[model samples]
Every structure is written in C-alpha cells, then in structure tokens.
Target: MKLSAIAAPHLFIPPEWDREINHIVIDSRDVKQGDLFIARVGRDNHGERFIETAIQAGASAVVALGEPGFRCGILGVPIFSTPDLLDHLSDWLHRAYAGVSQLDLTAVTGTNGKSSVTQYIAQLLTQMKIECGLLGTLGNGIWPNLAETRNTTADLSVVLRHLNDMAEQSIKYAALEVSSHGIDQRRIDGIHFKVAVLTNLTRDHLDYHGSMEAYFEAKRRLFVGGNIGAALINIDDGYGRRLAADKDITVPVFTYGHSDKAEVRYHNVELNARGMTATLTTPWGEADIVLPLIGEFNLANATAAIAVLAIQGFPFESLVAAASTLQSVAGRMEVYVKDNGPLAIVDFAHTPDALDNVLNALKPWNKAISLVFGCGGERDRTKRPIMAVIAQAHAAQVWLTDDNPRGENSDQIFSDVLAADGSDNFYCIHDRRKAIESALEKTDKDGIVVITGKGHEAYQEISGTRHAYSDAGVLIAQGYRKAGEDYVA
Candidate 1:
C-alpha cells in the first residue's frame, strides 16, 4: 500500500517518503524495512527512546507523540509528531482496513467473565456453522485452533493485523474481550462492534483505575463510543443494570439476567456435578438450556452469550441446543481427578468475586475443600483481605503462596493476607509448588483441592523474575492424573 493511502490526511507526510509500506509496528524489535514504526507513550518510558533501535531494525518512517528528545539526535527517516497521535492512528487504521466494520464483531467487557463470554460467543457461532475468530487471553483463531496471546485485548496494530488475517480466511464473525485498560488506552478505538456485551463489574483494578467510577467510564466507552449495532448487558450486576438504564445510547439495548424486566431471563435452574440446566425465557422463543459448565456464574455467562446470538437472528431453541455442546474455557473451572487420588480443580479466579464464585460453586461435592490461593503483587490491595475472608468462609483448608510477586517482597504479600484472617486454618507456603503439595497432603484421599490465582499460567514471578511453574501441571505430576469421580462432567 502507498504510504499516503494509510496516512491520515491531517498529518503531514513528507513528499519524498510517500512510498509503498508493508507493515506498521509499535515495538522496535518487530520493525523491518518498509515498516512504519509508531512510538506510543507507555507506563514507564516514552517509546521515543527506541527510535534509534527502530532505525537500526529497518523502520522506514516514524510517528510518535510529542517531539523527539535531543538525545535521540537527528533521524534519517521521515519523522512526524502529533499531540493527537492515537486518534490519528485510529483514523488511519479505519481507513486502511475499510472492511473491518463489515465483519460480524462482538465486543465483551466487564470486571470478570470477559474471556468466557467472548469465547462462548465464538464457540456458539462456530457451532451454528459460522466461521468465527476469537481474540483474548486464551488465544486468537477460529475456535479450537486459537493461538495464545499475552493480553486479553492486543494492541491496535496486532488487532488490525489479526483482523486482516481473519478476513482473509473468510471468518464471518469475531469476538474479542475488551479490557478496562484497553479501552482507557484507546487500543480498541478504531474497530466498530456489531454487538457490545457487559458481563458485570465489580471491585477490581482500583490500583490502576483509582476508583470504581473511572473504571466504569472506561468500560462504558465501548457501549456508547464505538459504532455499536446493539448492546447486551447482564442486569444481575449493579453496574450492568445502570448501563441498561442509560437511554443516551441510540443503538438497540437488550438486557439479560434473572430480573423481571430482563429480555432474556432464566428460572428454576438446576446445578449439579454434571453442570447446570435452566429454563430460559426469551422474546424470540423459550427453551431449557443445558450448559456443561460448573458454576452459577457460568450460567450467567451462557445467558449473556444467548443474547448475542439471539440478536444475530438465531432461534432460541437452536442456540440453547448448540450451547449445551460448547466446551469449558481453559483454566476457568477446569477439573481433574484420578482413581483413588484427591480431586483437583484449576481456575483463574484471582479477584474477590471470582474466588467467591468458584469456591461457592463447588459446594455440592460433599468433600473436604482445601484451597490454595494467593494475591498478585502490585495489584488491587483491597481485594487481598476480602479474598482471605472468602477463603476462610468457604474452604476447610487454606494455603497462601506467592502469585507473581513481581518487584514486591513475597513475605510482605503473605503478611498482608495473614493479617486479614485470624483463623487457624491458614498456612503460609512461599513456594507455589510446595503450597499445592501441602494442600493435597493435608487433605484426606477423598478431599477436594482447588488451586486459584494462577490457572493455565506457565510461570511464577518473584522479585522481577519469572520461573516456570503451573498449578495443574504440578498437580498432575503429583499423581492426580486419573479422573476422579467428583468430575462428573
């Protein structure tokens, strides 16, 4: 593509540099000849410092916020500066792709359940024989073939590149998990959403967002700002209810929950070892949906997904049937049990509400529940004490271990958790692997051990170092490979 074709008209492009370009990059290491390098502001340092490196790596041109520092010296490339760089980049991307808006896109955002809801939307669509691509923590691809990604929502350049790939593959639908940071940073500014979903909001990321209101406003940008065709919100959540009440949105809004006013509501739900079965009532039609998922929270996720599909014009009965066949998301309520071994569950429940929901959902096992959990360093400190309280209330045994204590003292993090609970059931285990072993050893053969904080995560961080580690991998290595009877599903 010509350089001028992708450049925003308002931004100045050197006449001599208006040549063909192959790609755009944010990281200097990924730059190549014919590539346009972008230096967006970051948390610690401005990307401007990497200009020389991008040049060395063969970046043809440079676009960044503000003027370059004197230390960067003179650049040989066409250097451009703009105070409104992000908005301009968004505009440029929209014009460059052109057909991105034509793809069926669903944007999901909330404190939790974003990954589950996004993946569910993709899976349900694929079951309907629709080619769908997913972008989130689990990875990006068409269903089972998804490749892993570092962030729930990738940066603008990566997202656009992936969207282009999906379009090339003829993917008709795409579901993405939109994070508060992503929205706040304008990572998703360019893309238009066909359906916007608000799973729920709770006390989380206050360390970064400062307050609940600011965090909510970040999420609210998706439903109102983007060219959204429709909105699906979980009214069971206070924040979701508030979002549904907003009449400023010109697009169609659909509410889902157990509330009397919900457009799609479920009643008389039966939850057991196998999963949950609920009688769903929707405006299009009604059906009893069977979800092979473990928690009441998952039932809520399914209801939210149903709303997305229903808005897409699928029959409620077929959505319900196809939903039953959907698989559980990795590391979210994943269960493993072996003959004559303890039952082990691996879940990515790091927040207060998420931890509470996962533990409460395991109530029907009728076995001693031993929980191994920890709080991440440099995160929401308020949730630490609250999680300690929840662990005490639900688990018969609690083991506190290091969960990515990056740049923070492991002992101090453990101390904060210890101060939260006065109970005698808690034990401090600094080693995560040892913590899992202790949880299993302290329980009876029929005992249930649940590992929280890090699920499907392959490493542990301590004092700015990441060591390879996994809760499920350690549990299975400890002779818990056989499927236990408790995992009926």
Candidate 2:
C-alpha cells in the first residue's frame, strides 16, 4: 500500500521519501526492508527505544506515537509522530484493509467458559453450512482446522490479518474470544462485532486488572460503547446481572440461564458421563436439547450458544437438533476412560470459580473424585488458597502440582496452595508429570481423576522458558485411553 493511502496527518511523509510500505510491524525485531515500524509505548517500556534497531533492520519508515527521545530526521529516513496511536489504530487498520470481507462477528468475554462458548458458536455455524472461523485459546480457523495463537485474543494487527484471510477464503462468520487483558490493552480496539457474549464474570486476572471492579469495567466496554451489535449474556452471573440491568446498552440484549427472568432459560437439566440433556426455553421457541458435553456450566455455555444462533435467525428446532452434535472443546471438562480403568478428566479450570464448577459437576458420578490441580505462577495468588480449600471440600484426594512456575519459586507457589491447611487431603508434588502419574496410580478402578489448569496447553512455562508438556499425552503414555479408544489392560 502507498504511504498516502493509510497515513494520518500526524505522519508527515516527505515527498522525496514517499514510497509503498510492504509490512506493518510493532516489534522492532520483526522489521524488514519496506516495513513500516510502529513505535508505541507499552505498559512497561516505550517502543521508541527500539527505533534504531528497527532502522538498522531495514525499516522503511518509523511511526512513533509521539516525539522520540533521539533524533531521527538526521538519519535520512521519514519519521512520523502521532500522539496516542493506539486510539486510532483500528481506524487506520480498517482503511488499510478496505474491501476485506466483513463477516458476522461475535465476541465472547468472561473469566470462564469463553473458550467453550466461542468454539461452540463456530462449530454450530459451520455445521449449518455457513463458513465460519473461530479465534480463541484452542486456536483460530474454521471449526476443526485451526492454527494456534499465543493468546486467547491476539494483537489487533494479527486479528486483522486473520480476518483478511477469512475474507479471502469467503468465510462469512467469525467467533472471537475476547479476554479482559486483551480489552484492557486495547488489542481488539478496531474490530467491529455483531454480537457480544458474556459467559460470566468471576475473580480472575486480578493481578493484572488490580481489582474486580476494574476487571468488570474492562469487560463492560465490549458490550456498551464500542462496536457491539447485540449483547448475549448469562444473567445468572452476578456481573452479568449488573450488565443486563444497565439501561444504557444501546444494542439489543439477549439473556440466558436457569433464571426465570432469562430470555433463554433451561430446566430439567441432567448431566452424566456421556453428556447433558436439558429442557431449553427461549423467546423464539423451546425444546429439549442434548449436548455431548458434561457439567451445568456446559449447559450454560450451550444455552449461550443457542442464544447466539437464535439472534442470527436460525430455527430453534434446528439448533435443538444440532445441540446433540456439539463437540466438547479441548480441555474443558473432557472425559476419558479405558475398560476397567479409572475415568480421567482434563480441564482448563484455573480460576477458583471454574474449579468449583468442574468439581461440582462431577458429583453425579459414582466413582470417588481425585483432584489434580495447581495455580499458575505470577498470577492472582489469592485464588491459590481458595482453590485448595475447594479441592478439599469436593475431592476424596487432592494432588497439588506445579503449573507453569514462571520466574516464581515453585516451592512458594505450593506453600500458598497448601496454606489452605488441607494438608490432610493434599500432597505437594512439584513435578507436574509425577503429580499426574501419582494421581493415576492412587485412584482405584472405580474412581475418577481430574486434572486442572493448562488444558490443551502444549508447554509449561518455568524460569522464563516454555518446556514441552501435555496432560493428555502423559495419561496416554501411562496406558490411559483417549475418548473413543478402548482400554486394553
């Protein structure tokens, strides 16, 4: 693209230096010949400090959020300075990617269930013959096929690139998982969303957000002022109730849950080893639905998915029938068992609320519950003790293990978890692999073992590095079976 096409007035491109820019890069290390480097200040450091590095790496032009500390004009390269570039970045991106296919986009935000809800929507849409893509924790792409991403929500530029690709591929629908950090950092600033779904708000990311109110406010932005076309929320959540009570929401609101006040309410809910069956009641219509996933939380997630499709004009009956085929998202209450072997579940339940839900959901099983869980390092520490308490309250045995002890003492993390004073019921095992193996060895054939945190995650971060690891892989290597595989013991 030409410099004149996407340039803001703050960016003064000299007539002599005017040239086409090949790529737009934020990180200095990624700059290359013909690339436009954007020097924006981040939470901890200013990108301007890396201008020299980008220049040396063959950056065509340097775009700074404001005046740099050093001289740039003397280098004979065009330097454009704009104050608060992040505020207008999305607009610039929209203009740069003009004619890109604009899909019907839905954004899901919450501490828990965001992954399941977004993935379910993408799967539902695709099964209905609509070309749809999903962007979230598991990865990004159309239904079953996806490429992994570093974050639940990628940088605004990365997201745009994916949207551009989706457009080129003729995909008409996209479901995005929007996280509190992503919203607070303005990573999704420019994307226009047709529907905003809030699964539920719980105590999480408090270390980054500083407070629950701040965390709530960050999530609140997506449903109110920005580019929301509709708001689909789980009114059962306390924060969701607050969001729904807001009379200021200009977009249409669709509420779902077991509450009678909910527009999409479900009753007669039943959960088992196979899946869940529920009697769903919605504004459009009602039906008994069966989803091949476990837990009341899954029921809520499915209800939220149903609400999303209903708003998109899909028939209630079709959605009901489609409910039977809704596949389980990776790591979210996933169950596996081998013949005569203990049933093992792997989940991404890192937060206290999520852990409680998953454990409670397993209450119906006849087998004794053995819990394997741990908190991530450098995260919200307050939840560690709470999780330990919840584990003791629910499980017959709790195995506490290291979960990505990045830069923090694994010993200290375990100490905090053990502080809950459930020493009688819990064991401290610093090695995650040993922890899983120990849990499996101890649980009887009639029991069930649950492993939480780091579900679908391929690596464990420790000492500022990611080491390869997989919860499911470890189990499989130990003679445990995959979902559809029969156990030969």
Candidate 3:
C-alpha cells in the first residue's frame, strides 16, 4: 500500500510522497524490509532517537510524530513529521488492517468485570463452534491459546496488528477488554465495535483518572465515540444508568440487570463456590443459564456476555445451554482444591469493592476464610484503608503484603492500609510468598484461603523490579494443583 494512501485521510497534513509500504512498526527493533517505521512520542523518550536503528533494520520509510518544524537527522530514507499525529494515529494504524479486519468485535469496559465479561463472551462464542479471539488482562490471542500481554488493552498499533493476525487466522469474532487508560489514551479510537458492554463502575484507577467522574468519562467514550453497533449497559450500576440515560449517545442502547426495567433481565439466582444458575429474560425469549464461575459480580458479567451474544443474533436457548459449559477466567475467582486440602481461590481483586465482593461471595462455602491481600503501591491510596477494612470484614484472618509497589515505599503503602483497622486478626507480612504461605498454614484443611490482587499475574513488582512469581504457582509448588488441572494419568 502507498504511504500517502494510508495516511492522507487521517493526517491533518497529508502525506506528499507515495512510498510503498508493507507494514507499520512502532518499535525500531521490529522494523523489517518494506516496513514503515513510526516514531511516535513514547512514555520515556521520543521515538525520534530510534530512527537510525529502524532505518538500519530495513525500514522503507519513517513517519515521526514530532513537534512542528521538527527535522529528521537521518538522510538515508524519506522521513515525514506531523505535530498532531496522536490525534490521527488510530485511523492510519487501522489502515494496515483494512483488508484483514473481518472479525465481529465486542469491546467490554468497566472497573472490575472487563476481563470476566470479555473472556465469557469468547468462551460462549467458541462453544457455538465459532472461532473467537480475545485481548485483555488475561492475555491476547484466540481462546485457550492466549499469550500474556502487558496491559488489559494493548496500544492502538498493537491492537490493530493483533486484530489483523486474528482475522488472518480465520477468527470471525473478538472480545476485547477496554480499560479506562486505553480509552483515555485514544488506544481504541479507530476500532469500530459491533457490540459494547458495561459490566459496572466503581472506585478504581483514581490515581490516573483523578476522580470518579473522569474515570467514568473515559469509559463512556466506548459507546459514544466509536462506531458502536449496539450497547449493553448494566442498569444495576448507577454509572451505567447515568450513561444509558445520557441523550448524546446515539446508538441503540439495551439494558441488562435483575429488574424488569432491563431489556435483558436475569433473576432466580443461586450462588456458591462451585458457580451459579439463573434464569435470563432477554428480548429473544427467556432461558436458564448456568456458569461455573464464582462471585455474584460474575452473574452480572455473564449476563452482560449473554446479552451481547443475544443481541448479535445467536439463538437464545442455545446460548443458555452453552452458558454452563463456559470456563472460569484465570485469576477471577479461580479455585484450587484437592481432597482433604483447603478450598483455595486466587483473584485479581485489587480495589476495595472487588475485594469485598470476592470475600463476601465465599460465605456459602461453610468454612473459615483466611485472606491474603494488600494494596498496590502508588495507586489510589484512599482505597487502601477501605480495602483493609473490607478484607477484615469478610475473612477470619487478614494477611497484608505488597501488591506491585512499583517504586512507591512499601512501608508507606501498608501504613495507609492499616490506617483504618488497628485490631487483632490482622497480620502484616511484607513478603508476599510468606504472606500466602502463612495464610494457608493458618487455615484448616477444610477452610478457604483466598489470595487477592494478583490473579493470573506471573510476577511481583516492587521498587521497579519484577520478580518471577505466581499465586497458583506458589500453591502448586506446595503440592497443590491448579483448580481444574486433571489428576488422572
């Protein structure tokens, strides 16, 4: 494709030269023969510094997102610049995927249920004999074949590239977890979503978003800005109701919740550590759905996924039947148990509400619960104390440790956590591994031990270093297998 043809429409200053290009590469190391290297403003340093390396790596041309009158020092290849490149990035980034993007995409946004809803949607689609690709905190790739990703939502360039790859691999459906940071950063601007889902909104990412309203506005972009075909809003949440009531959103909006007001309502719920069974009332017809997923919040997540599939024209009864077959998402109420061993769970419940939900959901287990949890350093300090209080409220014992301190003072993070709770049954063990081991050792064999904040995560980050670690790996290393791992040989 011609560079001019790819960029002219999106760029404020149209491309003057019509150089042929094969691919668009953001990283200099990824440049190959016939690839157009894009030097954009990165987090740390300007991408301009990598131009020479990209050129040497066989880049066909260079497009630099730089300041006005910015000069390209390298002379071997044609170089271009645009001061306002970020504004039009998604458009041109998507141009590379024009012929490849055939997947019907669903982008799910929320504070907590993004991963579960997206994963559930993918699982349900795959059960229907339809190939589905998923991109989120769990990883990025086709269902059950995902590779790990750094963020819940990938950068726009990576998003387009991954979508193109999924399309090439014959994946006709994709469900992506859209984070507030991703939306606020314009990482999802150009991808037109066939279905958009809201799981619910609560306190999270306040450090980055500054306020709840700003955080909400970031998520609000999904339904309002994108080429959204239909939106599934969880009217159960105040923010969801607010977003649904907004007059500016022009798309056909559908509501899903427990009440009759919801166009796709669900009721008659039975919950336990094993999973849930509920009757779903949808526009197509009513059907009972069962999911082997823990937490009452998962009911909402599953409902959102079911509503999305129903809106996409899948047979309602078939979807209801398939619901029971959907697998549990990693790190989201992920359970691990063996005969005579404790009922253990690993979940990514980093916020106050998430922790409360996970802990409270385990009440029907009919066993004493010991929780290992902590606040992430340098993130929404206000939630720290609240989480500590919530943890104590739900568990028989609370173990406090680090959750990705990331250069913040670990002592300070814990101090904030204990600011509210100055009582017994609260144990402070700074070492995460020790905290988990201690929590497990203290709980009886029949009791439940839950680890929160880092589910499915492979490493623990502290003071800028990430040590290789995993909550499930720690359990398995101690002779306990992953919740669903086969033991029959």
Candidate 4:
C-alpha cells in the first residue's frame, strides 16, 4: 500500500519517500526490507527508541503513535506520525487482510480450561468429518496437523493470515483460545465470532492485570460490546455467573453446568479410572457422553464444547457418539503408570484453583498422593505460597521444584513458594527432573504422583536458556507405561 493511502495528509508522509510497504511490523527485531515499522509505546518503554534499530534491520518506513493519541508529522527515512497507531492497528490490519476468510469462530476464554475446551471442539468436529481449524496454545491448524504459535492468542496479523490459510484449505469452522492478555491487547479485534464460551475464571495473571476486576474486564470484552453472536457460559463459576447476568452482554446467553440455573445442564454424572459418563440437557437436544478423559474439570470442558457445537446445529446423536471416542487433550490428565507401583499424572495446573481441581479430581482413586509442583518465576508471587498450602493440604507429600525460574534466584523462588513458618510436608527440589524422580521414587505401589505446571512443554528454562525436559519422558524412562498400553492407573 502507498504511504498517502494510510496517512491521507502529505505532512504524515515524508516528501519523495512514499515507498511501497511490504509488511506491518511492531517489534523492531522482526523488521525486514520494505516492512513498515510501527513504533508503539508500551508500559516499560516507547517504540520510538527502537526506530534506529528497526531502520538498521531494513524497515522501509516508521510510523509512530503520537503521544497524546492523535497527531501527524514527518520524520527522517520515509517516517511518519499517525493518530495512535497502536490503538488503531486492527483497522490497518483489517484493511491489509480484507480478502482473508472470516470463518465461523468460537472463542473459549477463562484462566484455565481454555486450551482443553478449544481443542475438544476441534477434535470433536474433526471426528465428525468437519474441517475445523484450531488456534491456541497447542498450535494452529486442522486437528493433529498443527504448527507452533508464539502465544495462546496470536497477534492480529498472524491470526488473519492463519485464518485465511485455513479457509484456503477449505476449513470453514474454527475454534480459538482467547486469553485475557490477548483480549486486553485487542489481538483478536477483527474476529467475527459465532459464539463465545466461558469455562471459568480464577486467580491467574494478576501481575499484568493488577486486580481481579481488571482481569475480568479484559475477559468481559470478549462477550460484550456486540462482538460475538452468542454467549455460552459455565454458571457453576462465580465469575461466569456474574458475566451471565451482566447487563452489558446484549447477546443471547446460554448456560451449562450441573447448577440448576444452567440452560444446558449435565446430570447423572459418573466418574472413574477410565473416564466420565454424563447426560447433557441442552436447548437443542440431549446427549449421553462418555469421555476417555479424566478430571471433573475435563467434564466441564467437554460439556462446554459439546454445548457450543450443538448450538451450531450439529446432530445431538452424532455428537453423543463422537463423545465416546473423545481423546484426552495433550498434557491434560495424561496418565503414565507403573506395572504395580504408583500412578503418575502430568498436568498444566499452575494456578491455585487448577491445582485444587486436579488434586480433588484424583481423590476418587483413594490412594496416598505425592505432588511435585512449582510456580513460574517473576509471575504472580501471591499464588506461590497459596499453592504450597494447597499442596500440603491435598497430598501426603509435596515437592517444590523449579518451573521456568527465568532470571530469578532458585533459592528465592523456593522460599516464596515455601512461605510457611513451619513446613513439615514440604521438600524443596530445585532440579525439575530430580524433583519428579524423587516424588515418584518415594510413593508406594498403591500411591499416585501428580506433576503440575509446564504440561506438554518440551523444555525447562532456568536463568535465560531452555533445557530440553519432559515429565512423561522421565516417567517412560523409569518403565512407566502410557495410559492406553495396559496401564495401571
């Protein structure tokens, strides 16, 4: 596109330098030849400081967001000033990718279960011969054919491009995992969502959001403001209930849960070592589901996906049949068990509520449980000690291990997590691999070892570098079998 097309005024475009732009880049390091670098001011520093670096990196033009939100001027090297370029970035992105496909999208948002819910939707649809693309923490694509994404919700430009690619592949439906950060930053601003699903929200990401209200406000933006076609919520959650009843949500609201208030309620629920069996009563029809996934939270996640797909006009009987073949989401209640020893579960339960749910969900086994978990460094510090207390209360033994202790002292991280004046049940293991081994080695034949935080991740980061590591890999090396292969779990 031409410089005059975006800025309109001659003053906003440098004289004799209206060069053709190739790509719209925000980060200076990502700039390339003919790319238009956007200097957006952030919380720590302004992007104008990186303009020189961007230029050296072959950026064709630099358009910086005006300090007071709206202004226009000329700068060196085909540079220009625009009216809050960062704030209005989505507008330019929509224009740039105007021909991109707008698939029937369903954005699943919450602190936990975002990945599980989104993936379950994609998995179920794929099983029914529907081409559904996925965009979330797991990756982006159709089913198992996925590529890595930098974030759970990617940048607006990447999202548009990915959706367009999926559409080109003839995939008409999409499932998206929308995070609070993504919603707050307007990364998914131009998405035409068919339905917005809420699993539940709890204490997570308080560091960036500063408060629960602010965190919820970011999530609230996904459902309200006339952006989505319908709202599907889990009424069992306090926050979900608040959002369901919130006057700001102008769209039709559909509720799901075991609660009486839920429009799409599940009853006669049964849980066991194999999976969960439940009957779902929805506005469309009824479904008798038998999922191969463990955890009551998975029950909620599965139901949310089933309800949303039903709302999209899929047959209830086919969905009910598809439910029986549902596979466990990667790293989510993924089981690794010994021949006659303790059962080990690898999960991504970092938050207090998620940890609690995982522990509670494992209670049906009626075995002595050993837990190995740790909070990520430089994150919401308040949750660290809280997690310690929960671990001590739930498990017979607790191992506090390293979980991405980036640029933070390992000793300091453990001390914060082990905040108690007295810790009779805590064992500090700074090494992640050793922590998993120790936690498993000490457990009895009938016991269970639950590993939380950094699930499905292939590496462990300490200091600044990520070292290759996997909890499941460690267990398999120890002769523990995967869940489906004559497992003892």
- Cα lDDT tens digits, model 1, 113-171, are 98898888878877888878888888887787888787888887878778877887787
lDDT: the better of candidates 2 and 3: 2
> Model 2: residues >4 Å from true position, as ranges?
29-33, 52-58, 68-77, 99-101, 485-489
lDDT for each residue of candidate 2 in 1-489, tens digit (9 for 90 to 100): 877667755355566777688767777876889777888888788987998888888887777887433234535667777775776667766666654437888899999998898888877777777777889889987777899887888877778768777887888888899999899888787677888999999989999989999999999998778688899988999999999988879988989999989989999988776777889989888799987777899989988987888898888888788778888788887777766678899999999999999999888776699999989999999988999889988899889999989999998998888888755568778899999889988989889899999888989999999999999988888887667522312
Q: Lowest lDDT 10-mer window, candidate 4?
A: 67-76
Between prediction 2 and prediction 4, which has the larger lDDT? Answer: 2
- lDDT, model 4: 0.83
* Model 2 error, position 447 (Å): 0.5
Candidate 4 residues lying further than 4 Å off, grouped into runs, are: 1-21, 32-34, 52-58, 66-77, 485-489
Please identify model 3 stretches exceeding 4 Å from their true place. 9-19, 29-33, 67-75, 423-425, 485-489
Q: How close is each model in CA RMSD to the real structure?
A: 2.4, 2.5, 2.9, 3.1
Worst 10 residues of 2 by lDDT: 67-76
Ranking by TM-score: 1, 2, 3, 4
Model 1 clash number: 4
Task: Give the distance in Å from residue 42's predicted Cα in candidate 3 to where it truly belongs.
Answer: 3.5
lDDT of each: 0.83, 0.84, 0.83, 0.83
